[model samples]
Target: MKATVYVTIKQNVLDPQGSAVQGALHSMGFDEVGKVRIGKYLELELNTTDRAEAESRLKAMCEKLLANTVVEDYRFELEG
Candidate 1:
């Protein structure tokens, strides 16, 4: 199985890098884009068939170490 996790800052959070990227894009003539935010994407491979258990473990993994829940939100997709 494979899991792809995305972790990003909640709205109202500061994202300097994203802002920089947006500025660069504007300078490069991509003016339609605004309020860009950055995030982390993690891909994991697991050897398991139990979907529920794997999701539980994956949630725990995010809560414990993969993300900082205090200011970040995360979502994951799993596929076999």
Candidate 2:
């Protein structure tokens, strides 16, 4: 199975990196941007025939390492 995880800061968290990128983009002539957020993506491939087990394990992984539940949000999808 293949899993894709996306980790992003929550709406209430301050994202200085994203702000910097937006500023640079504006300086480069893209002035329509208002807000931006930086995130991390993780892709994993595993040998698992049981989807339920995979999902549970994936969630645990995200909770442990893939995302910081205190200030970030994360979601993942699994595929073959």
Candidate 3:
């Protein structure tokens, strides 16, 4: 099985890197882009075949290390 995790800054938090990228885009004439947000994508290969167990473990991984629950939010997908 495989699991993918997406970790991103919370909506209410300020993202300096995202802001910088947005500013650069605007300067480069990509004015249509707005509210840029930066995030992390992680793919993990698991030995387990149980979808429920994989989801539970993935949630723990995100909560404990993959994401900072205070300022970041996370979502994951499982595949075999």
Off by over 4 Å in 3: none
Clashing pairs in 3: none
lDDT of 1: 0.95
lDDT of 1 by residue, 1-80 (tens): 99999999988789899999999999999999979999999999989999999999999999999999998999999999
Question: Each model's TM-score?
Answer: 0.93, 0.96, 0.94
Q: Model 2, range 3-70, lDDT digits (tens) per residue?
A: 99999999999999999999999999999999999999999997998999999999999999889999
Which whole-number lDDT from 0 to 100 does residue 42 have in model 2? 92
Tell me how far the alpha carbon of residue 6 in candidate 1 is from the true structure, in angstroms, after superposition: 0.8
For model 2 the TM-score comes to: 0.96
Candidate 2 wrongly placed segments (more than 4 Å) = none
Q: Could you give me the TM-score of model 3 versus the true structure?
A: 0.94
Model 3 residue 58 lDDT?
90
How do the residues 1-80 of candidate 3 rate in per-residue lDDT, one tens digit apiece? 98889999999999999999999999999999999999999999999988998899899999999999999999999988
Query: In model 1, how large is the Cα lDDT of residue 26?
Result: 99
Task: Indicate the residue-level lDDT of 44 in model 3.
Answer: 96
Give the C-alpha miss distance for residue 35 in model 3, angstroms.
1.0
